[model samples]
Structures are given as C-alpha cells and as structure tokens.
Target chain A: MDRTEQERLITENRRKRELRYIATFVLMAVIFAVIVVLNINTGSVKISVPEIFRVIFLRQGDKVKYDIIWSIRLPRIAMAAILGGALSLSGFLLQTFFSNPITGPFILGISSGAKMCVALSLIYYIQRFGHSSSVIMILAAFVGALLSTGFVLLLSRKIRNMSILLVGGIMVSYICSAVTDFIVTFADDSNIVNLHGWSLGSFAGSTWTDFYTALAIIGVCAVVTFLAAKPISAFQLGENYAQSMGVNIRLFRVMLILLSSVLSATVTAYAGPISFVGIAVPHLVKRSLNTAKPIIVIPATFLGGAVFCMFCDLIARTAFSPTEMNISTVTSIFGAPVVIAMILKRNGGVKQ
Target chain B: MSEYVSASGLTVGYNGRPLIRDIALSIRRGEIVTLIGPNGSGKSTILKTLTRHLAAIGGTVTIDSEDLSGITYKELAKKMAVLLTDRTRPELMTCRDVVAMGRYPYTGSLGLLTEEDQKLISDAMVMVNVLELSDRDFQNLSDGQRQRVLLARAICQEPQVIVLDEPTSFLDIRYKIELFGILKKMAIERNTTVIMSLHEIDLAEKISDKILCVKGDHIEHFGTPEEIFSTGLIGTLYDISPKAFNPLLGSVEMPAPSGEPHTFVISACGSGIPVFRALQKAGKPFAAGILYENDVDWQVAFSLAAEVVTEKPFEEISDEAMRRARELIDACEEVILCPVPVGSVNARLRELINYARNAKPCREA
Candidate 1:
C-alpha cells in the first residue's frame, strides 16, 4: 500500500524465496550424499562404510572390495547421477521451450528416437566390427534425438495446442519403439543379449570411460544452459514476450532444441531410454523450490534429478538383488505418480 | 513535442503475406494512440510489426528518427516494451517476480536485479497500485490484478514506447478505467508513448489522443478522437447500424422496436430515457416528442424511439415540433407523461400533455 510497506513486502518475498532455494538445495545435497553412500554400501558384495571410504579416498583396501568400489559401483553411481541430472535438465529445457510441464525427451519421443537409432547402430556395428563404441552410439543417438526433436518442432508449428503436440509425440514414440523392436527381433544372438538389455533401459555396464564422456558432454550443456537462464526466464512468459525482452527467438529456439536433444541423447546413449525422470524430476524440484526461476530451477533440477535417479538406481540394484530390475522400472514406479498428480493439479487449478 | 514514433506506408501480416498495407502514422511524444477495428482486422498484426514480434512485410517504422529494423533487439528493448494478448501462466512466480522480468534488458547475464532495478520495480508496481499484490502468486491473481501486474511489468521496462495488444480484453469496466488512468499518467508524466488496440471504442474515444481505424486491407482513418468520432466512422468501422451508436454520447443502444407506434411519451431533461427503454424492451414501437437536440434524453430517444419530434437546444418548443407531437399523440393508442421540469422556455409541453390527456388513455411514468 504505502512505499515502506511495499518495499518491506517485496523484500520479505525475496528473502522467503532465498530461504526456499537454500532449503531445497540443501535437502537435495543431503539426499544425494545418502544415496551415493547407500549405492556404494548395499551392492551384492557387502562392503562396510569404513572400507568403502578407504577404497574411495585412501585408495587402499582388499583387492576384490577395491575393484568393486572403484570399477563397478563408483562409475555406475557417477553415471546415474550425471545422466539423471542431464535427463532432468533436458526435460526442464523442453518444458520451458514448449511452456508445458508434461513435455520431456521421453514424452516427446526424443529418447525413443535415440533408442531406435542406437539399436540400429548397435546391431550394425556389432555385426561389422564385433562391438559398438560409446562414441558411435552417442553420435547415432544424437542424430536420432535431433530427428525426433525436428519432427516434434514441426508438429508444434502446425499444432498450437500442447495436448495435441504431446499426442503427436506419443505417436512418434510408438513408431520409433516399433522400429527398435523390429531391429532387436532379428539381431544376432550376442547382439540381442546386449540390445535387449540396453533397450529395456539400465545404468549397468557403465565404465569410467562412459562416465567421463557423459560428464564432458553434459557438463558443457549444463553450463551453457545456466548461462542462458536469463533468456529461458523470459521465455517462460511466452515466445512473444521473450522476443520483446530482446531475446532472438529464432536463435534461442535453436539453442533450446539442440541443447535438450544433446542432453537427452547422452542419457539415452549410455543409460538407454529412461522414462519419467525428465518430466518428474523437474516438476518435483520446482514444486520443492516453490519457484520456476531458471537460475534456481536449473541447478536445483540437476541436483534433484541426481538424487532421484541415484536412489532409483540403488533400488534397482538392491531391490531384487542379483536379478537387477531395469532402471526404467524403478524410475517409472516413482516418477509416474508425480506426473499424474501434476496433471490432476493442473486440470483442477485451470478449472478454478 | 515532435513525432517520437512514425510509420509510413507500413505493411504488416504473418509469414510474408500482407493483411494490412500502407498504414501511415505519426504520433508525438507523450501521446496515447488506440487502434479500433472488428475481429481479425489486423490490429494485432500492426502492433506485432511495431513491436518487432513479426517482421514488416513492407515499408518502415522509425523511433526517434532511427529506422526500426536497424536497431538490435536489445537496443530496441530499452526503447520499447509490450504487453501481449497471450496469457502467460508462469509457474510458482509471485507478482513481484513477474514484474522483475521487465528489467531483462537492464539486468546482467543472470538477470539479478540491482538495488536501482529493485526500486524501479517497486515504483512500477506502486504506479499501477499492485504493490500490495506483490506477494501474491501471479497465476492466482484475478484477471484485473494480472493485467495490472503485467502493466507494471511493462512500465518497469522504462521504455520510450509501450505497445499493448488489446490490453483491456479480459478486464472489467472498473479495471479498464484504472488501467487507462495509469497509462494516461505515464504518457503525460513520463513521456511514454502508448500504442494499444481496444475493443471498447467508448473508452478508446475518451483516452486516446489519436485513433487509428483499421479495416479491410488498409487504415480506414487515422486522426484525433475528435476527428474520428465526430464523423460517425465507428459505426461503419464495426459494421453496426449507424443509429445504434451515438457518436455524441459515445454509447451504443439496442435496435429500436419495429412496427407502428402504439404509445407516445412526453418528457424532457433526461427524464424520458427510462420510459423509452421500457417501451423498447416491451417490443412495442413508441414515439417520443418535443425534446431538444442537445439534451441527454434526445440521445437515447434518437437510438431507441421509432420516431422523435426534436427541437434545438435552449429554445422554446417550436410550433412545428408541437404540431408533430400532437399528431403523434393522436395516432398512438395511449400516452405516458414523464416527470419533466416546467421551465418557462419550453413550457408549451404542458399544452401537449393536456392535449395528449384529452385524446388518449394517458398515464404518468
């Protein structure tokens, strides 16, 4: 009402927002630490915390325990965290681009498209050279992701309604999945064994090389996305408003599509096509932070996605023990309900 | 002030195709211009081109004597702000957060608002009287409050020109008045030129310094509100019956009831509007009489009455008007006398009332 009151109210709101950001980030960090330790501690070979620390930090432990920690569990955990963060960040970018929370690499068939291409390349490279390199797989997945993104963007141009665009994405997802299945069904026995596991979506068999490659690609993308937070924030208001605020809409859109595709492509290349982590993690992080300001939501979503996927990965490994469930199964079990709740809330709130 | 914004032979539309062409406009600094047209008449297309949301199909626009297309978007952002018709449902954003976005052109790469930016944000919010709502979630605010917050967002941009596309579409009458009051103050005090399209021509007539009539493939008319409204161009612009719109009063009335007159009403001095409306609503054709041309009652009667016997302002009722009134009273089945003052200049209305009482079944309204 008055000048002093108005200033006080705004300052209070800002302070409250700061507190929310701090709390959400801190909670995510704590959960991330716990999940990392749990992922290390509760594998098939029971390694104690002290021994896990010695193997990780002191680099002196029994040969078998050290090998499991350094070679197997650590890379898998790092891959899950990095890929999870990348997947969620990719989803956040897509949601910002589409202005719809329901959209993500998975929902828009981007991940499925990557999966289809990776499947084809896997069979082709394995048949020709007896093995598929991670670089080749990533390149193939990136192309496939871009192809799917291009189709979605084309459909989005003709269909202004988000629901219709989503339906179109689902159709694309189905078509790509059918193609991947067709490839997998006729592959060599050894290729089928590999392609079937990858197609089902898992974070297993991730090596330090895979981890470092994902880290390099996703790390660059995350920094670029963070730097572009200003435009992304403007974009949340809608395309016209963003353009009015000095954002080159054409360039900004290209950047969004490329970044989102690359991030999702990296995840799909390494982890296969994981579902719902992209959509669900960003939604949860924004709801927890109580804001969608990209500067805050970007890093927070990455952290939140890391925690979510690491925890899901731990469960996938330990839930059934030896008979490891696909990471997608765990992520879907936890992530799908959040997406459903979000949809219900959106529908009810829009009605009001 | 000189022309702050000028467009000559500008053509605007979507996808390289032109919808409206050859629009020439020159507006001074601190002026408010409004575009009025029917639905899908290219009002938004013209505004979009000016805001650079859409590329111009032809011609050029200049701001402060600089070719509009020559300026970078960032430089243009400092000079122009827009409030579009698109509904933005930003998630988890407070009204203050939404308003703070206006400082995008001024803020650093990360868009952290400095203290001065904060002050301007507060000032803008205070200017629009949304300071109290600064803490409310933007998506939860009512339409009126959302529009004000968005106006606050535009104001904080500190632009030389503010372009809005139908900014008052979702607002009610009270919010409409408040929003325009803020725009007028900004135009006068801050020297911010305001360009917006409006569906409400009455408000546009009252608020705008210049009115651009958009229709068909070109600007139908562009001039001061006096020049535009005085010539009854709004009726032709919207394609409504000329009699339905009263240019003098800047209000519209429903079509008059059809068929022969069944009732005659005698009233003046703003007393006969209610009676005329009642007869019109009952779908009975009515004749109203002996009112001066400049009277408020005459405006309503002209629009809603089947026939009206009128006299010039501030004169005695002429014999010709009285004769016409008498003839109307004779033809009607009944006559109603509204409470009118007995002024000496127009006291002949007492004779008409007496004549009507003697000739027909008369009643007081």
Candidate 2:
C-alpha cells in the first residue's frame, strides 16, 4: 500500500523472475544438447557413442561410419537444427509483425508459396541443364516467399480481421499448390521423384553446402531481430504506440517483412516446408520464458525450434526403422496440439 | 514563453476532407484546456489532429513554437504525449510494464528501464493510486482502474503537453474527479499544458482555463468558462431545450412538468429538489414557490414547476409575494410541503406550510 512495502515486494518479484529465466534458459540448453546427442547416436546402423565421438572429434573411425557421419548423418542433423531455428525465428517475427500469436510462415502460406517457386525452378533447371544449384533454389524460394508475403500484405491492408487474412493466405496457398501439382504431373520421371521428396518436406540427403547456406541466412536474420527488441516491445502495444515511441514505422515494417521472409525462405529451400514449428515454437519459447520481450524470446525461440525439430527428425528417421515418415508429418503430430491448445486457451476466455 | 500548443487555420476530418475548418487555438504552458460540444461536432477529430494521430487536412499546429510538420516523430514524442479512446489490450503485460513503456523515448536500444525511469514510473503510479496494481495484468483491471493506470502511463512520459480524447467517458465519479485532479496538478506543478475533450460541460466549466466550443461546421467559441457558461452557450451548442439545462446551477432537469397546475409545493433552501423530482416523475403538474431567488432549489424548480412564485435573493418577504403564494396554495387540489428551516429573511413559507399542514389534500408525505 505504501511506498516502502511496495518496493520491497517488487524487488522480491524481480529476484524470482531472474531465477525463473535462468532456469528456463538452462533447461532449454540442456534439452537442446540432449536431443542433438540422441539424434546423432540413435540413427539406423547405429555406431556406438564412443565411436561416434571418435569419428566426430578425432576424425578417425570405420570408413562406413565415417561416410555416414560426414556425408549423411552429420549434414542431415545440421540442416535440421539450422532450418528448424530459421522457421521458428521467422514465426516469432511474423507474430510480432502482425501482433497475433497464431500467425506464422506456415499458416500464412509463405512456405507453400516458396515450395511452389522452388519446384518450378528445379524443373526448369534440371530439365534444361541436367542440374540445379542450391543458390538458385534459395533465390527462387525467396522470390516466391516475397510474392506470398506481398499478397498477404495487400490483403491485410483491406481487412483487419485475422481470420479473413488467414483465409486469403490459404487461398493463395491452394493456388500455388495446385500449380505445383500440375508441374509435378507433367514433369519428366526423374525430376518428379525429387520434387516429391522436396515437396513433402524432408531433411534427408542434406549436404554440407545446404547446411552452411541455411546457417548463414538464419544466423544474420536472428541477430537483427534480437537487436530490434526495443521497437518490437513497443510494437506489442500496437502500431500507433510503436510509432509514438519513436520507432520509424515504415522502415521497421519493411525490415520485419524482409527478414522474416528470408528466414522462412531459407527453411523452404533446404527442407521443403516444415509444418507447425513456425507457429508453435515461438509460443512455447515465450511461454517457457514467461516473457515475450524480443531480446529474450528471439534467441530462446531459435533454440526451442532446434530442440523440437531435432526430436521430430529422430522420430521421422527411426519410427519404422527404415521407412522414414515425412518431417512435416512428425512436426504436425507434436506441434499441432500446441496450436490447438493456443486456440482453446484463447477461446476459453471468451464467454458465450 | 510562447503558447505550449497552438493550431491556426486548422482543418480536421477523416480521409483528407475537412469536417471543421478555420479552427484556431492557443493554449499557454501550465493551462488546462477542454473541448466541449455536441456529439458528431468533431471535437474528437480536433483532438486527434492536434495529437497527430490524424493528419490535419489543412493548416499547421505549432508545438513549443516549432512547426509540427517540421518536427521529427522522435522529437515530437519527447515534447508531447497523447491518450486516445481506442482501448489497447496488450496481452501478458503488467500494469507497471504498460506504464514503463512511457519511457520509450528515453530508453536504450533494449528498452530496459534505468533507475531514474523506474522512479518516474513509481511516482506516477503513486499519484494515480495504482501502486498496488503495479504487478497485476493490465487486461484484468476494471475500466476505472485501467483508466488510472493509463493516466499513470501518460504521466510517466514527462512531456511538456499531454493531449487526451474524452478522458472521463467511462470512469465513475471517483475516478473522474481523481483524474481531473491529477491532470490539474500536472498542468500547474510540472508546467505541462493539458488539452482534452470532455462530455461533461459542468466539469469542464470547473476545470478548464479555456473552453473551446465546437458546433456546426466551424470552431464556435473559445474563451474562459465564465464567459461561456454565463452566456448559457452550452444548451445552444448542444441544441438542448432551454429548460433542460440550468447554467446558473450547472445542473440539468427534465422539461418543466407542463400543463395546468394541480399541486402546490411549499419549500425553500434546497429542500424542494426531491419533492419536485417526485412530482415530475409522477407526471403531476406542480406549482412550487415561496423562495428566495438565491436558494439552490430555485434552479430545478424553475425548470420543472409549472409556476414558481418567487422573491428576490436576500430581500424581505413582501406582502405581494405572500398573497401570490397563498393564492397558489388555495388553488391547488393537493399541497406538498418540504421540511426546510424557517428563516427570518424569507419567513413567508411558514404561513404556506401552516395552511398545508391544516388542510393538506396529500397524506402529509
């Protein structure tokens, strides 16, 4: 009630908050380490942990084991982590940009649009030159993502309702998917199989080059988002308040769109489009951290996405021993429930 | 110093067309200015334009004598703050966090609160009596409490001028009074110019140094509340019937119970207010009388009573007045007497009360 008593209580609350945040970050780090170790160790044709470590650290092991780690398993694991982080961080940025918790690259059809463009480019390049480069795929995905984002942005300007905007996004997504289907149906047989695996969204047969490309794009975007924490915090109040707080709204908006698009595009180019992580991981990170301040949530969201996707990738690889489930299938199983819970939690607060 | 905030030839409206044009205003530092007008008269549009929430279709607003369009948003933010009617429901933010956001112009890249910023926030919460609410989620607060918390946020901004649009609309009496008090203190103590639109003309008359009357397609009047209220401008500005608002008492009443007089009320010194109300609600045409002009009862009585037999304030009861009061009492079918102190200056009511007590047609209620 009085000044002295209230200050003491706030101080205690701050102390408790500090401990809680520390515990959460430490827990996330621990989970991330555990999932990474388990992913590398528990794959098919298992190499023992000591042999895996010797192969990873000492650069010496059985030739087959070495090939699996260097050429197959290691790159696959790295792609999963890097692309997963990219997806969730993009989701976080979109959620902030729209000021809606449920918005993400996947739900907004950004990934689907990117997949369509990547498919088109792959078919054109492979049919003409007998080859397709990662650079071209990333560029095509980026262009497709911008197209979808542009549609959503124009639609959002006309409609303030999130559900209507989501419907528009889905419609745009459907058109792109239909066109991709037409391409797949007409493509020559060899490229058709490659398109099937990429469209279904997978982390298989990933190479070191794909891993490095995803790492560079995601890392830069994530850091920029973190640096924008102050404006993002103000933005949570609404756009007017964010502008009133000295944020250059026009520039800030363009940056958010560009960065989020690049991150999601990188994910799509590397792993097709993983579902739900873009919508779910940011929610989980903010929930665990108990704060949505971008300075903290952005990094935690990246780590959370890494841990979640790695775990899902493990199940996708080992669920049937050799018959791998699609990575999107695995993510939807775990991440869709979180999304459903978010919807229920939101609707539960409204009275009939 | 030049006026803290002023607009000249300002035209404000939606979608780039002017709703009210050629508006000019000048508010001094440490002054509280209020805008009062009829609904749909564009008071809010004017406030919005002044706050830069809506761009002015034409003309310019000068803040601290600087051309508004020339000022950067960051510089303007350091000099002014605005609170509009749009309810901002920021999820997962505590009241303190909402208030702390007022330090945006001063905070670093991460928006972390410095020690001095925290002190300003705490002091603002104390002023608004929301110290205990600091840790509570902002969305969970009741409307009145939420209003106070927002006032605290505006205070934390430490701007030279604060513009609020309809600041008292949803608040109860206590919150309204407290908010006005806080606004007044800020204007005087911090030398912050306060500009806001209020629906309460009565409160506006009491609180504002300058009142802007908006009506029709133009800025109607801008002057002291004395000049505005004494001219009985509010009723005309609002298109209200003459009897609906009593400018002298700063109160409102139903259109005087019209028709032939059927009941007489004997009262003076503010006691007849309830009796007049009851008679008005019952739809009984009443003639209420025998009072000094200065009595608080006269305003409502003058509004509701079919005929008010009156005497001048502080004047002795004349024979003519007593005769008029007795005649009205006799003509009435029923008499209602209000229990008022029998004073010497206007003891004429005693004769009327005795007559009612002896032969009152109503049940002496």
Index of the highest-lDDT prediction: 1
Query: What is the C-alpha lDDT profile of model 1 across A167-245, one tens digit per residue?
Result: 9999999999999989888888899988899989899988999899899999999999999999999998899888888
Candidate 2 to truth, TM: 0.95
For the predicted complex of model 1, DockQ is: 0.80
For all candidates, the clash counts are 0, 0
| Per-model TM-score on C-alpha atoms | 0.97, 0.95
Summarize candidate 2's per-residue lDDT along B1-365 as a digit string, tens digits: 56778899999999987899999999999999999999889988898888777888999999999988788888888888877777777767788888888898998878888889989999999999998898888878988788788778888989899988898977999888899899989987899999999988889988999999999688779999999988767778998887787777778788766788899987777788988898899998989888778888888888899998888888888889888877887788888767778778767667668877676575444
Note the residue pairs that clash in candidate 1: none
List the candidate 1 regions with Cα displacement exceeding 4 Å.
none
Docking class of 1: high
| C-alpha DockQ of every model | 0.80, 0.65
